[model samples]
Target: MEAPSFLDFIIHVTGLPGYLVFSWFMILVIISLALIVRSSLKLMPEGIQNVAESVVYGIYSFVEDILGKEETPKHFPLLATLAIVIFFYNIVELIPGFIPPTSNLNTTLSMALIVFLYYQFLGFKRHGIKYIKHFMGPVWWLVPLILPIEIIGHFARIVSLSVRLFGNIFGDDLLLAVVFFLAPWLVPLPVMALVLLAASIQAFIFFLLSTLYIADAINEAH
Candidate 1:
């Protein structure tokens, strides 16, 4: 097991779960960062504003490529928010005396469930009752067989999204703990760097999969 975070003291005092407390901390951190960035924004985009704009524009371009210009505006907020929040949650493990909330299954599963339900809602909104045709397969005769399979597959996305993120982050934290135990000094530096890269990749992957799910939901081709 990993060493207790500084938040553990607060957790004990408040009788709150560590993940719950840290998750709220993470949200506060993100909100504070957003406020700071907003206050620093300039018309010409210099300093922190430039970096923030670059990050937002890069994310917007990515969404545009996947979702097209028209749909990108509608979906970019959720995609960008997910990517940024998940990235922060993943990378927080690098901070001393902090535990990443993403390392917990509950946090990951909750986010996955939100994505799953949101896309389903979008599908129903876009196509109404006709959205049921998505489960009926390409042929009308396959409804009975395909419906259950399709339902299972759709539900499986929640498991896939949640488990994949939770497993990776939890494994990363475990590895870090073991490494720190074995070598508490310079040896962990390289590992920390790799963890940072992995965190970024995982965040992007979640974003990409979410975009694809939303695209599938809104596409009339379904």
Candidate 2:
């Protein structure tokens, strides 16, 4: 018997076939995020609430270092959500028969696009008409030259963020698959441990770069 695809199942029930694995992961992430946030807000922290608070505190502290205390609160939602969801997916990647949604370019690119649009929005919102002025260097004549370079650099961030995340997680997934297929024993153990570490590091790297991007966007001096 052939295995059923998500499209097949969806079309069977709802007559839509465009849904994909990323959609599934997105749903899971939303549900999990809601639950964690709700739990974290409970009157008494315990179990999942405790864990969630610790994670949020760590992310807030990390963001504070880059964006400072005042800016951290403004940007903490995106930064914290990204770190938590990415870390969760990364952890899921370690399980047998599971791969991180972030291992897919679709997911990572979507995330990068969100970060890109969000920071740009914040920049324009905070600076009003002056946001455009940042791209135009201090010298009036240099505006024309600096504008394109700044635009290219901004767009490049989307590509860099997406590719960095997809490459690392996918590479780890691929390596683990190869090792498991070949050895399936003690040899794969250390590799799994390393992949776990990689997952954590990649999540932090994503968060760090995102925080820096937001900081640059909302920086007063530009």
- Per-model RMSD to reference: 1.8, 3.6
lDDT of 1 by residue, 1-222 (tens): 443555677798899878788888899988998899898878898887788789999999988998899999998998899999999999998876678899999999999999999999999999999898888898888888999999999999999999999999999888888888788886456999999999999998888999999999998845
Clashing pairs in 2: none
Clashing pairs in 1: none
Winner by TM-score: 1
Off by over 4 Å in 1: 1-6
- Estimated TM-score per prediction? 0.94, 0.83
Q: In candidate 1, residue 13 scores what lDDT? A: 86
Backbone clashes per model, in order?
0, 0
